[model samples]
Target: MAGAGGSSWVPWYEHASPVLYLEQLLGNVLKEVDMPLEERDAKLKFADRLQSLTQKAILKEYPNTHTNVALRGFGSFASGFALKGSDMDMVLMINGPDKEKLNFKDIANALKQSFKADGLGVYIISNTRVPIIKICEKPPAWFWEEQEKLETQAAVEASAFKAGDGKNVVGDGANNSETSHSMTNAGVSGEHSSESEAEDEEEKEARLRRKRVTEMANKTNAPKNSKVWYRERKLGKSDFPKSDAGILCDINMDNPMGLENTHLLRCYAACDVRVHPMATFVKAWASRRKINSSRDGTLSSYGYVLMVIHFLVHIIQPPVLPNLQHPQDWPGLQDLLHDEQSQFFADAINGHWIHYVRNVDALNYYGSKNISPNTMPVGRLLTEFFSYYGDPISGGHSWQGHVISLRTRHGGVLDKGEMGWNRATSEMVNGIEVRQRYLLAIEDPFETNHNVGRTVTNEGAGVMRREFKRAVSILRGMIGRGTPREDLMEEWVDKVVVDEGGQGEGNVGRGPVATDGPLSITASLARIGM
Candidate 1:
């Protein structure tokens, strides 16, 4: 991993720090909690396939509409912080002259019918602010077989080309064509040993190499027996299909802001290497603690991401990241301002100015150029993050009257009263009484009027705060202790008990907290005079 200025990252233990053990423990915990490479690859491939299929379905179903339709992915998957089995969020963008006349409900119904006709299970939800088409289905047996076959063929061709015998191979086309069709027709069959014994030693080695590559590709592309491959492993409820489907996709039509926000986050993630891992760790912690679901009246994953960004860019001393939305802070803005077509300038979208610095690479080493660059390791950053949010006595963030705002120049902190969101208000929405609370206000960077934490209910806010405090107490207790990394990891990430008897459904119970010895988490907190 590279640090802020693209230098090799120094490990936490290399620093002359007192919390070396804690840093090592947290580093190991991040590794354990992160998604595996294989799983991430499979999920991304599934998403690509689904996007292709959906695009084809739209074109086929609306042949006479003359509309240019495109599907774009957004949210965590696009922002590079997606956990294992995270749902793929996409927008079905329709262009052309008649696009303004199109009805979302009608379009969703048409797409649902088209997907069902193609033997896929789909649901259309039209009552929400933005209509959604939920698609879930296992790829047919032929689909998996074809995928494996194509991957195997490509691997063999790659191996053959690398072995330096491209001329001798007849009509293989592996030397000339990179297309999948050319590779498939390269005269390589499923059987690997069909070559004659009279072949030279070099050819034999190439054949053996091809066979090994093919086997590995087949293993990776083969479909697994498990159904609902995208469901979370630990907590929360997933409405995704429980059958042998390998992916779940949510398609919407009216959320271009989501795509913009995803790009904004991607740029922020590109600023520093520590940003992604820290955000992922915090998100996993929130999910495990049962406070990550917006539908269940808590903060969404996007809100947590904003919180992490706020901490890194504004709250932390000698910020680990620059506010990409702040044009004055970015030196590259001068060039972009002269370019009329540059997206770096704000666009008037839905009565809001949606803008951010899109060319992240141009502002090279902006983080490290600060008067006092933050050279803290990911472990130290994470520790400070927990302290800032959880331990109020440590002179950290106080969520009572303040709001989290990433767009602000003043430390990402805003007064709730100044924003006119000081108290809870109830309004009628679609004939139902809807309540909006400012308990945990988080202003969206672009859509400044939208509070990302409006879904957090009073009880949900309490639960989240409690979890935050618990994390702070436990981490404090475990710091400097010679506890095994595995034990510390389990205590932090895996040791959670669901409070079924609590007022809310997925409330977390306070179990044994972090301690190297026999003392409980509560006892450790008492020992530290918390």
Candidate 2:
């Protein structure tokens, strides 16, 4: 709403509509951060080609086996929050009973060889918590591979339907029994033809006679239920052999639930129109502030996403997001909480409580039924988000003492103790040490035992809070004062200097303050109820 009219700027809040300002702000932010559709599509195509090559190489190395090698997209690529040039996170799922015999080192070696042969730069980093192979860019033959794939698909489709005199057979008899038998042998045929039709007429007739004799004997020997026999035959010739145990036994691994989390975020975005822009703006802000990297002792992108969700769900005046995972009407949730695993006390004798709730359909729908649609201006929400989390110590307590949990509705806060989190104690689950960090506590929506905020250190959290406050101040100043839109928009991120318990704390009109403004620091503070 603070548009420049003939070089004279307008105050944002006093403008015709606050939503207009939010729309403009989001448009500007997205123009800077969002990847173009064409570029995103090209990158995805490159990833698919690279994955195909890797799969072919692995299969070649371990030939004549039931090894099912595939590259599954994860992380931001699968999630909707990917930026331009964001590295794709892919997981190699080697499915099959014999997959246990395949060594991860061998797989890595095969990937290395494939990348080398293609003349692409690749790094096989297997030392980390989750092993990954980093690829520089798409290979030179990527376009060629795409073209070849298209041609091969066309040929396959053409071959699937061919001219026949009167009667026709469909698919190779070995692999197409189910559909082949179901189809009529008239002029209409399937996309695939039977391989046995290529044999000499005499040999085919002889084989048919032998099959009839065998069927007669088997029918007499078989049980009364013919459907069971058909079902067995239908499922018998699966490509991947079954293991003795029910489990896949491929590396005896834990499921990568990251894909599920990605789906959850995608649903949230689809349900609300405002979530994506808000998330993107926060990501850009975090990137500018240099507090977004986990390696730098701060939060990861996922951490930032969780933070945004927390604000939208709990901090807003009328909650923008519903407590999907632990809604008040969620069935069996009350009884689930009474279970021993959800109850954790220091001296409890049974076991350490690990809160793990799987509410699959909670995020299935996004529109608000509990509360009205939160149509608050995005700009105001952004300011409030920063203000709420910016202050390290507010209301006579630090953020470390509180927990940001979706389980508690009505914008509620759950203490760390009741949530089975403590800094003084550590527990071992499945040979991995689980320790709680009191710096910041963010309960995982599904896996309650896991604190997503554990990655944030004490100093790192303080820095982030300070940055948030600084952002709030700058944005507030830009809106309150009739600052030249261009001047405030330009290099605004660079102007927020981190205060080290020194001067410039609440010192208005200091670095990037507008020269003329009606609003004051006191007014901004009052807005946030500080």
User: lDDT per residue, candidate 2, 70-124, as tens digits?
Assistant: 7666555566787654555555677788887777767776876786577654433
* Per-model lDDT: 0.59, 0.48
Against the true structure, whose lDDT is highest? 1
Stretches > 4 Å off in candidate 1: 1-22, 33-41, 139-238, 241-244, 330-343, 360-372, 429-433, 479-530
- lDDT score of model 1? 0.59
Tell me the TM-score of model 2: 0.58
